[model samples]
Target: DQQVKQNSPSLSVQEGRISILNCDYTNSMFDYFLWYKKYPAEGPTFLISISSIKDKNEDGRFTVFLNKSAKHLSLHIVPSQPGDSAVYFCAASDLSTSGTYKYIFGTGTRLKVLA
Candidate 1:
């Protein structure tokens, strides 16, 4: 089966606090991973990505870490703001594919940043 899983349906965090999201996968063949953040009704925007060759990636206030051996990954956001409230999706792709990169997304985690 294709891999990648985000178990939580939603997360609530107070503004200025840290938010953590979790994900898991079953397919070992996946070598590239990405995280996307989406506002209501809008398409997801790329947040950060990490290659299988690396264990971690960070961008501004967002960070992602991957543990290949355990098939797990996580997203971390610091100083969460109300504007940060949105749906987050975890996606993975196979690097061997050519031309196009197809992404398999998780069900989605809705993060509500409380003011």
Candidate 2:
């Protein structure tokens, strides 16, 4: 079973506009949720993260929101740019007291920013 899922396979937006990507998870053990941006031929890089203790986290043009009760999370990018065109992935880490931490990732959502 997929613990994390990105319902949309892809998203397109005009440059300088807002882009929103949604994700959902089924694991309640997930305490840390993260977003990653990956370009072709490159590894995914960390974007932003939100802890289950917090509802939201923002950095510059990127923001992440987590709804624990709904088991959902979303990433918002303001003023999207062409450079932002890439695959976005939602990841969650389960921090267990027994040291059974594991990271689960969504399939990924390809975002294309048109000029």
**Best-performing candidate as measured by lDDT:** 2
lDDT of 2 by residue, 20-92 (tens): 9999999888999899999999999999999899999999999998999999999999989999999999999
Name the best candidate (by TM-score): 2
Model 2 lDDT, residue 77, Cα: 98
- Candidate 2 Cα errors over 4 Å, as ranges: 98-100
The residue ranges of model 1 lying beyond 4 angstroms of the native Cα positions read 97-99
- Against the true structure, candidate 1 has what lDDT? 0.90
Report the backbone clash tally of model 2. Answer: 0
User: Tens-digit lDDT track for model 1 on 25-55?
Assistant: 8888888999999998899999999999999
lDDT of each: 0.90, 0.94
